[model samples]
Target: MNKQQKIIIISIVALTALLAWVVLKPVQPSDTATTTTPHEAASEHAHDHSYDHSYDHAQAGDTHDDEDVVTLSDAQAASAGIVLDMVKPAHIFTMLTLPGEIRFNQDRTAHIVPRVDGIVEAVTVDLGQQVKKGQVLAVLASTGVSELRSDALAAQKRLSMAKTIYAREKELWEDKISAEQDYLQAQQDLQEAEIAAQNTTQKLHALGAGTSAKGGLNRYELRAPFDGMIVERHLSLGESVQANANVMTLADLSSVWAEIVVSAKDLGTVKVGSSVTVKASAFESQSSGVVSYVGSLLGEQTRTATARVTLPNPDLAWRPGLFVNVEIVAGEANVPMAVTTEALQTVEDREVVFVQTAEGFRAMPVKTGRSDGKMVEIVEGLQAGAAYVTKGSFTLKSELGKSAAEHTH
Candidate 1:
C-alpha cells in the first residue's frame, strides 16, 4: 500500500473506534422515577381566592403524583388517629350569636341593709367571704334597741309589784275583810301594769332584739338571711349607718345570669325558655343555659333589649363581668352537603378539607356556610357523597406542611 493511503486508513480506523466507544459504553443506571413533593403539589394546586369552585377547577381523569398526596393505609390511618366520613345532607341550626356578659343572678342576689340604726362595733365577715345562713355578719350597738329593752324591764317590775297587791286584795275580798270597791280598784291597777309590760316586750321582739342582751342592752348582731358570698362591704368599724342604708351585697354564685344584648329585630327569636349556648370570649370554655328573661322594652338610646340566660355554675367558672357570646338557635336548615366544623382547615389562606382518594388524601379547597358549631354547610367545591377526613384532619394538615417544608429544603 502507498504511504498516503495507509495514513488515511489509520485515521479513519481511529475515528470509527471513537464513535463506537461513545455509542456502546456501559450506561450507569440513572434515577428513572419522578417524584412530586407536597410543596410543589400545593403550589400547583393553588387557585384563585373565590369560595365558589368545583374540584379546584381540575379536569376529570387527572392523576395526582403519589408523593404529592397524603397516603395512609387503613392500619396506618388508624394508628395516626385519622377518621373518615362521607359528605352528605345534614341538619344544621341557624344560630343567632349575640354579645353578652356574665352577671349575678338577681333572683339569688341580695342588697343587705341593717334594719335598725346602729354603730358598727365589730365587722366579722370580709368581702368575698362565703357565709352560711344565719351567720353573723357584724356586731352593732344601738340605743334604740337598748331603750326598748329598758322599757320592757321597767314594765316587768311594775307587773310583779302589782301582782303582789292584787293577790292580797283578792284574798281580802274573798274573806270579806275589805270593801268590794277597794278590791276592784287594786285589780284595775294590776291590769294596767300587765298591759304596759306586754307592750314593751313586743317592741323588743320587733327590733330583732332579745328581751335582754349579754354584753349590753344595746348590743346587736347583724346576720345573713341566706347562704351566699359577700360581694361588697360598705360599712367599716365604728361607722354609723341609717336604718335603711345598704351595708353590703351578698350573691349566691352557684348560678349566674348571662345577660345578652339583643337588637329589636332579634327579639322575636329570643323567647323565654329557649335553649342557649354560652361561649367565653377570652378562653376556651362553653356552657348551656335557658332563656330566663327577655325584656319587652328596648333601650331608648341603643334600640336593644336585654335578654338573660340562667346558667348553672357548679364549678364557679363563670364570673360576673366576663364577656361571652350567646348562641341562640332560631331555626333549622337541611343542607345538601355538610361536614363537621372540626374537619374544616385553612390552607394558603383558603378553607380546605382533606378528601379521600384512591392514591391517598388531597387537601381540597371549599366554600362553607352556616355552621352551627357542630356541622358546617358545604356551599361550594365539594360534591355530595365524597368521603373526607373529619376528626383528625389537623394531622393531615401537619403532614402536608412537612411535605411542603421538604420541598423547600
Candidate 2:
C-alpha cells in the first residue's frame, strides 16, 4: 500500500511543478513584434521629463525679456530735438548776503534838553518839524528866570546910587574942600559901580538873555542845537519839565546807518571800508555805502555779528528801523565759468550734471565753487554758457539710473 501511495504523490507533485512553471514563466513575442525592456522604458521616460523641464525653463526666461531690455536709438534721440552747446566765459561776483535795518547816524543825532526846571509854557516845534540851528523850539517859565531879572535890576539901582555919591565926592575934592583920601575913595567907588554893572550884564548873557538897553525880563527858552528834523518830542504845552530833561530828539537825516547782521563765520569777509549795496523795500532804488563798523562781539542767540555802513540819505527816503537786504561784494572774477543752480544734480555721493554732446545728453561729473542765489560758479568740468540740461535734468538722470541697472543684469 505505501509503494502505490508514494508513486501517486510523485506523479501529482510532478504535475503541480509543471503547471507552476507554465503559469509563472514570461510570455515570448513573435519576431515581427517590437518591444522595449524595463530599463529602456525607464530611460525613455527620464529623457522626456528632462526635455519638458528644459522647455519650461526656456519659456520662463523669454517671458521676462520685455521687462529687462531698453532700446535707445540715435534716431529717437534726434527726433526729440536734443542739441549740443559750446562753452563761454562770463564774470562772476562773490557776495555775502545779510539782512539789515536802517538807523539814524549817532553822530548826526541830537537830544534837546531844558537848561532850567520850569513849566513848558509853549511848544513851538512839533514832532517831524524841521528846525535850524538856534531855532526856538519851546518856551519855559521858572522862578530862576525871575530871580535873574531881579538881581540885574537891583545891581543897576545900586550902581546909579554909587555913581551919584562918587560924583559929589569928586567935585568937593576938586574944589579943595575935602581931603585927598575922600577923592580917592570916590574914584574907587565909581570903579566899583562900573564893575558891578558889567557883572550883572554878563550874568544875563549866560542865561540866554540879550543885554539890551530896554532890559527885558529873562524867560527860559529851549533852542535847537543843530539843523535837523525833530523826530521825537517829550514836552507838551503847560507840562512841568525838570532841568536837564530831554524835551525833544532831533536827527539830521543827511546820512543814515545801515546796520546788518552777518554770520560769525562770514566775519572775515565783512570788514570796515568794504563796499555794500543796500536795498530797501520802501524805495525801488538801491543805495551804496562804505562799511564803517564791524562789531567784535558775536550775538549769543543768533551767532552773528553786527556790521554798520554809512549811507547818505539826502532825500530822507530811508527811514530808521526799515528792513533791508544787504549784499556785500567781497570779490569778483574776471573770466569765470558758471552755470545756473538748477543744472546741478546729485546721485548718491556724486554731484553730476548733463552735458550736451554730439551723442546726446551725457552725464558728467563736476567740481563746484561759490554760489550766489541765481548762479553757481563752476570750478571744474563745466563751461560757461554751455547749455547743460537745466530744466529736464532730473528726467535724464532717472533714465540713466534705469539704464545702469539694466546693464548689471
Candidate 3:
C-alpha cells in the first residue's frame, strides 16, 4: 500500500475507537442527583426489616390490642390515681379572712401623765417594765404641792387657836358666866376652822400627796393607774414635764385587741360576737377570740371599717404593733353536702368537680357554697355518697384538652 493510504486507514480506525468509547463508557452521576449507593440501599433495607420485627415484639408484650383503646371526652369520667370521699351531710363553716394588727385593748391601756407640772426627779419604771396597779412609775418636783402644804399649815394653825378659844368659851357657858351669843360665836369659829382643815387635807389627798411625809410638794411621783407593762416612756430623770404631759404609756397585756381593718364590702359579713382566730409572725402563737367591736364609720383614707377581736394574752406573746392575720367565722351551714376543696376546679367561669364513673371521670358542673378551709360545701349538681377524684384531676384535664384539640382538628 502507499504511505498516505496507510495513514488514512490508521486515522479512521483511531476515530472509530474514540466514538465507541464515548457511546459505551459509563457516565458519572451529577452532584445534584441522589447520592444513594447500591450497598447503602441494601443496608437500609436490612435495618428496616429488623426494626419492624422489634416493633412487632414490643407490641406483643403490651398485650393491649387496638380493641382495648378507651377514649374519654370529660376529665371527671376518666380513671385517676386519686380518689375522693363521697359528698355527704356535714357541717361547713364559712370563714372570712382579713389582715390585722396586734394592739393594746383600749380599756386596758393607760396613759401615764403628771397631775401637776414638775421636773422628773427619778424614773422608777423603764420602758417595757411590768408594773402593778398604784405602782409608782416615776417621781417629780412641783410648786403646786408646796402651795397645798402651805395652805394646810395655815389651816392647822387657825384650827388650833379656834379650838383653844372654843374650849374656854364652853367652860364659861356651862358655869353661866358667858352670854349665849359669845358661846355660839366661839363654837362657830371652831367649826369653821375644822372645815378649813378638812378641805386642805382633801386637797392634798387629791394631789397624791397623802403618801409624802414632807409637806415639801414634790409633784414628782408619777404612778401607774392600772396593772400593766410600761410600753412607752417619754420622760427621763431631770427632764421637765408639763402638767397633763404624757410620761409613759401602760398596757395590760393579759388581754389584747386584734384590730383588723375590714373592707366595706366585708362589713356586713363581720359583726360583733363572731369567732376569730388570730395569728402573728412575731411568735409561734395562735389565739382564738371573738369580735368585740366593729366600727360604724369607715376609714377616711382606706374606706375600710375597723373591727376589734378580743384575744386573751396570758403569755403576753402578742405585742402591740405586731402585724397579724385574723380569720372570722361569718356563718355556718349544718348538714350540708361537702367535698374536698381540691376536688373542685374552675372551668372557665363555672365551677366544676370530677365525678368518677365506670367509664372514667366526668366533669360535673357544680354550684359551690361556703368553704371551711379543708372542704367546700356543694350547693348543687352533686349527690351524697357519690365517689369523685380529689387529686390527679389536673392530669385528666390535660388529657381531655388534648382530645378536644384533636376533635377540633
TM-score of each: 0.74, 0.54, 0.62
Which digits, one per residue and each the tens of the lDDT, describe model 2 over residues 1-409? 6899999999999999999999998867764265778898899999999999999999887644432232346675455444444445547778877899999999999887776678878899888999999898988876776677777777788888888888888899889999989878877877887788788778767766544434235467778778899999998988998878888899999899999998977898999999888998676767889999999999899888999999999888899999998898777774467666767778656677777665557666788887654467678887666767656566666777787677568
- Could you report the Cα RMSD, in angstroms, for every candidate shown? 11.4, 12.9, 12.0
254-341 in candidate 3: lDDT tens per residue? 9988889999989988899888888886666788898889999987899999989988888888888999988877777785588888
* Alpha-carbon runs more than 4 Å astray in model 3: 1-89, 215-219, 281-283, 334-370, 374-409
Which clashing pairs does model 3 show?
A: 76-361, 76-362, 77-360, 77-361, 77-362, 78-360, 78-361, 139-220, 140-220, 140-221
Model 2 lowest lDDT segment of ten: 63-72
Candidate models: Cα lDDT each = 0.89, 0.78, 0.80
lDDT of 1 by residue, 182-218 (tens): 8999999999999999999888766556787689989
Name the runs in model 2 displaced over 4 angstroms.
Answer: 1-91, 153-218, 299-303, 337-409
List the candidates ranked by lDDT, beginning with the highest.
Answer: 1, 3, 2
Model 2's alpha-carbon lDDT is 0.78
Give the Å error, residue 233, model 1. 1.1
